[model samples]
Target: MISSSRCTHLLLLLPLMFSFFVMGFVDLVGIASNYAKADYQLTDTTANFLPSLVFFGFLLFSVPTSILMNKIGRKRTLLLSLCVTMAALLLPVFNKSFAGMLAAFSLLGIGNTLMQTSVTPLLSTVVSDDELSSALTFGQFVKAIASFLAPLIAAWGVHYNVFGMNWRILFVAYMLIAVLAVMVLSATPFSDEKPADTSGLRSTFALMRRPMVCGCFIGILCHVGIDVGINATAPRIFQEYEGLSLTHAGRITSFYFICRTVGCLLGTFFLSRVSNRRFFVLSVVCIMCGLIGFAGFRSETALYLCVALIGLGNSNVFSITLTQALQSCPEYKNEVSGLMIMGLFGGTIFPLAMSMTSDGIGSQLGAVAVMLVAAAYLLFFAFKIQGKR
Candidate 1:
């Protein structure tokens, strides 16, 4: 029979894991931006702005959200985020204008920013240090489930005209899930650890002065830049190189997430048995190889293979780098969480940069070049992780 303590632990974890699914909602921005571009007849640079707007909140709101968590606790902050996400998802269903969609995505970014900042540290509160990496990987695995599903669901909605919503059905479906997440998480009790001291923006920024914290911050920046970069660009690559329709090209994004989902599932077990530094180095190598393939190959098959490499390799980067930063300064997990999450603003920087580079060069190779630079930084970061030990 299960002990009450063990049962309670599982109970606590289930809600948090579901929250990770909610966190995955932000990834919809990729396919959604593509769809929005097609619908509005937008230029590549203008379409890129959708995702940039979505992630821009990380730069503006992450540190403040951490400060908010200190006052209200992580659980409450998480709930607020879910509520905002619900609003975001609900908006496009009613307002189909481009401006309306822009507003919706902006709210989605802000909500996700709040959720991302709070959820990982909140997970640390429930699990011990040893289990944290595995737990975080597992959480990402759950998140990837939602991430991979977004494109599939959008495609399904477009094909079937589900409830006459077309692609906007993605918003409705996710809104319902966000509502469910809010309900389930609200009902479950979490013992939120109050921060030992208050954290302001200044103190949060100061955490970056520490080498491990700074390196991990850049690691996160590169990790997210690549993740968002691929999500936003892969489908276009398919279209440019293979002459595929938007619907067909969209599957490329789903395929990337599918590979990532598999990698995260495998990582959950592997991280428990292996050292983070070793696993991290291997993951970075996979991404570097994938990016190299992207630059050199033009075949559909070759591109798909490269996507798989990147997805698998990048699957556990966020968890590993985050765990490193949190472990580096156990006392300031909240502040560090904020600073590290702020690195996600790299999502904004990368897509805009990639878009301009690709547009200027008149080839997707320019975008691949940008991601290769990010991959190279991750490779360098692997050495830093080793040095930390």
Candidate 2:
């Protein structure tokens, strides 16, 4: 039987986990961008900019958000993120123009930067150090569910014409959930650690001087660069190589997320038992293998297999890399979390780079080439892990 204290902890965790679901909302930019491309006839470079905009805030806001968390506390910081996200979702419903969507996604990015920075540190407040990796992986599993659903919901909205909003219906649906997330999280209570005496920008940046923290930071950059690279490119790959319609090609994105969802779910258990370094090595191997297959194969079956392999491998990268950074500076968790989340700016960088390469080469293979570079870095970073757990 669980103790009352353990049960209370679990109860409090429910809202925090739901907030992870809200974090997944930012992933909509992938499918939403594809639809936007079609809706507005955008060039590859222009459409790619949408997801880039969604990630740009990570670079700008991550450290500042950490400082804010030090002031207002993590829970309140999270609440502020949700409020911004709610406004982001609300924008598309009222204005469907290209500029409007861009503005909305920009807000979504800013909101997500805050949420991503706060959520894990907030989780640490509730969970034990021994359980932090598994707990973070589980939270990611929850986030993956939201990631998995965004494409399907948009697909369904497009197919069924949900209230005639079409794909924009996704924004409406997620907005309502954001509203609920805000309400639930507001009512639930959790204690946060006192602010560190030196969470300033200088101290946060100084962490990069440590080799372990620095390597993990680059690993995060590569991990998210690969993650968003795949999220935005998978459908395009299917379309380019298989000649599939956008509707059918879009399913590849869902398939990728399905594999990612399963990976995160399994990781939540496996990470607790396996050596972190060993697992990281194996995951990078899978990604490298998938990238090779993606570069060489045009067959639909092979492409699908590659997507699955990459998704499963990449699923736990963020959690493992982040756990390393957070544990490295246990006292400056908020600052470390901010710096780690800032690496998500790689999302912006990778997609734009992939887009330009694909455009220049006239093939999705260029994009795959870019991701291969990221996977190579992850492979190198895997050996840098210091622990058995």
Candidate 3:
């Protein structure tokens, strides 16, 4: 049986896990919203604003919240983040204005940025090393679950006719998960100790200069961009290019995430046998091939294979990146983690940039091009590390 202390700490994982529900919706629809925006009589540029707005909040809020955790400790930061996460998800229920949804996404981004930075350190405080990757990968499993489930959520709302639209009901359920997460974290026994002395703004960069740290940070940015890239584009590729309805397309999208969750589960076992550095390199190669496959072909079966491959290939990235970043600075765990998540500012803006570029180029294939760029960097990082080793 798990100890009561361990149980209490693990309970906190629920809120962090659930925040992805709001995040998944925002992440998955980066490209799909082109359809929604057009349906609602909006410009492609205006539609692309949702993703940029979300990450903008991440950029603005990540460091301050990380410092707050240092001074006040994990639990309070978590509660505040969880509440914001819930509010962010629920805002669309009452207000459907494009600008309002953008505001909500911004709040959600800030909430997620805090959760992303704090919860891993919080989990590290709780779980043993044997279970560390397990817990982290399990979070990925839940994240994939949220991503996979989100499209169905959008579909269900369509079937039932909520908010004169479909995806709004999806946000309703995401808000409920956020509430449940908050309740669990409130009851958990996480510590209130300061995380780090992040009071000085100059410290953020001073903290960033450790060898391999920037690579690790940039690695996360690229990986998130890649992960978000697939989630963002998979639906449209499956629906428009593959010719499926919202529901059927959603089911196929779910398969990609299911494969991702499985990859992480499998990664926990393999980490004992393989080095993370090697795994990340191979995963990037596999993802490169997957995206290139999508670019090369139009067959539905092939699309499913490629999408699942994309998730399976890169599922280990976040854990691998975080582990390396922290391992590089064993003492400065929370600060490093904060800087790493703050790097996710790229995930938000990159997708929106891709969308706008697609507008000018007259093809969403610009999404694929954005992905190849990320993969190229991954390959370069992998090579750079190999040269050093």
Question: Clash number for every model?
Answer: 0, 0, 1
Residue lDDT tens for model 3, 149-216 = 76666777778888676667877877787777777667666554554345555676687777678888
Question: What's the CA error at residue 111 for candidate 2, in Å?
Answer: 0.3
The lDDT for every candidate, in the order shown, is 0.91, 0.91, 0.72
Error of 3 at 244 (Å): 4.1
Off by over 4 Å in 1: 387-389
Task: Compare candidates 1 and 2 on lDDT and give the better one.
Answer: 1
Candidate 1 per-residue C-alpha lDDT over 22-60 given as tens digits, one digit per residue, 9 for 90 to 100: 999999999999999999999889999999988989999
* Full-model lDDT, candidate 1: 0.91
User: Candidate 2 lDDT, tens digit per residue, 21-93?
Assistant: 9999998899989999999999889999999999999999999999998888899999999999999999999
Lowest-scoring 10 consecutive residues by lDDT in candidate 3? 26-35
lDDT rank order: 1, 2, 3
The ten-residue window of minimal lDDT in model 1 covers 380-389
- Winning candidate number (lDDT): 1
The order of the candidates by TM-score, greatest first, is: 2, 1, 3
Comparing 2 with 3 on TM-score, the higher-scoring candidate is 2
Clashing residue pairs in candidate 2 are none
TM-scores of all predicted structures: 0.98, 0.98, 0.89
